[model samples]
Target: MERLTGRLVQMYGNIVSFLRKCIFYILSVGLIPNHIAFIMDGNRRYTKRLNLMQGAGHKVGYSALMSMLKYCYELGVRYVTIYAFSIDNFKRSPEEVQSLMDLMLDKIEELLREESIVNRYGIRVYFSGNLKLLNEPVRLAAERVMLATAKNSKAVLSICVAYTSTNEIVHAVRESCEEKWDEITLLNSSGGYVPDESDHLIKVTDIEKHMYMAFAPDPDIIIRTSGETRLSNFLLWQSANCYLYSPSVLWPEIGFRQFLWAILNFQRIRFYFDRKRKQL
Candidate 1:
């Protein structure tokens, strides 16, 4: 009887998993998100849980990202962005930081060599952070990947390495100021008056145009794994209207199920917003 009971429990678990998949599929068909961003948290935690080396955790996380990107593209998401490394990560132990830098360089090279993957998927890759901080090899690899996939329009994949939202804002401000100066000079040459700084404060839209992600639409859903709810200074401007989803799974352990759950939750919230807008 004990053996029978064990079998029954296993069967029940399978049945529940199947039901969840079906429900997720049905819900997703009705409401698809255009853009999804991931924080890709918990690589170190996953490595610790598995008793693996620190760098192994990052390798597993990279594999997970590859799988998840394919799933997102299959689900009809046109744009995806992932937070690979933050600016603060450079403050980690020297050894660990070196490992991460090497890993990034290796991954970028691998991606560049995978021309079949690019051609099959028509996916364009872009790096949306301060690339100046990266070592020459990694920087060149990133640039190659970006150039190689620049014409692909089926999907846009953005990786944020050495990125900080605050720094991004500061950079945008400086760029806007330079553009303003140029515009003012041009206007003056044309005998048109340019507004003084006191009279023309920078508007939100002007600042947005200077941002690295200015060409891309805002993400509709943002997912963070490892149960973290904080944005950790990521995409402050683009994420203003995004739906946040925090899953308990570590980055490597997160599979299609977690993705589905995030999409379903996003759909429900989107419906709510639609109704609210209609009422308004």
Candidate 2:
């Protein structure tokens, strides 16, 4: 009886702690970030813990993503980006890679059918990455989503699949070089020496405009799940001034409450930066 009583007491304490965290989050909801990004990590770990199938963790994580998106939108965040799959993830087993690709295509198709909720809320969906690497079906699905949500102005949601920050930067640089070469050719036709693409000078600003996320503002807050402290090659250019948070919970375990806690922590960081800027 005493052991049972002690277990009950511990459970009660956990409940109280959770309640206090929720209250704190509620009080700071108004200070949520304008743009947020998430590294949805640890689906495999969660699945292992539950002794479930390999893909079951990703399925549960997808549900968590849906919930978090609604919560973030309700909290007034105008933009959210999630690192759904990285370029390095292609190194995983062929079966696992195929499963992820199939899942992504399925999710995009599902989102299209749920147009009522998405259109009503004015959410625009974009897929960012080296899209050429994706299969034709997945590519077409992504294109369809972009087209369907083209007119949405309320919120922007970006899914990064087969993406890497370094690759993005390199692509941007190559594009800038091409543009510069074109300009040099135009000038040389009138009199100046023509420059090769490799010889074309590139500026950071020029490369920035060519990046996939160039149309959106830099992320204000970045959240990584499953206790990972690293960025893992997410938006390198855009994360310069971003606040980062890592929660021990796996992506599948995250929900509205975890979203709220991240926002509250972001508010605290924003306050600190604001004060520092004023002093300077």
* RMSD after CA superposition, every candidate: 5.8, 6.8
lDDT of 1 at 74: 66
User: Residue by residue across 46-113, what tens digits does model 1's lDDT show?
Assistant: 88888997799899998899878877876778899999989999999999999999999888877766
Q: After superposing candidate 2, which stretches have Cα over 4 Å from the reference? A: 1-30, 115-117, 193-200, 274-280
List, residue by residue over 1-280, the lDDT tens digit for candidate 2: 9999999999998896688557646765456678989999989999999999889999999989887786677657799999998999999999999999999989888887755446657899999999988889999999999999998899999999889999999999999989987887888888877556786377778999999888788888899999988999999988877788899999999876677777777777787756754674
Which stretches of candidate 1 lie above 4 Å from their native place? Answer: 1-28, 189-198, 274-280
Span of ten consecutive residues with least summed lDDT in model 2 = 20-29
- Full-model lDDT, candidate 1: 0.86
Give the range where candidate 1 is weakest over 10 consecutive residues by summed lDDT: 271-280
TM-scores, all candidates, are 0.86, 0.84
True-vs-predicted CA distance for residue 200, candidate 1, Å: 2.9
Best by TM-score: 1
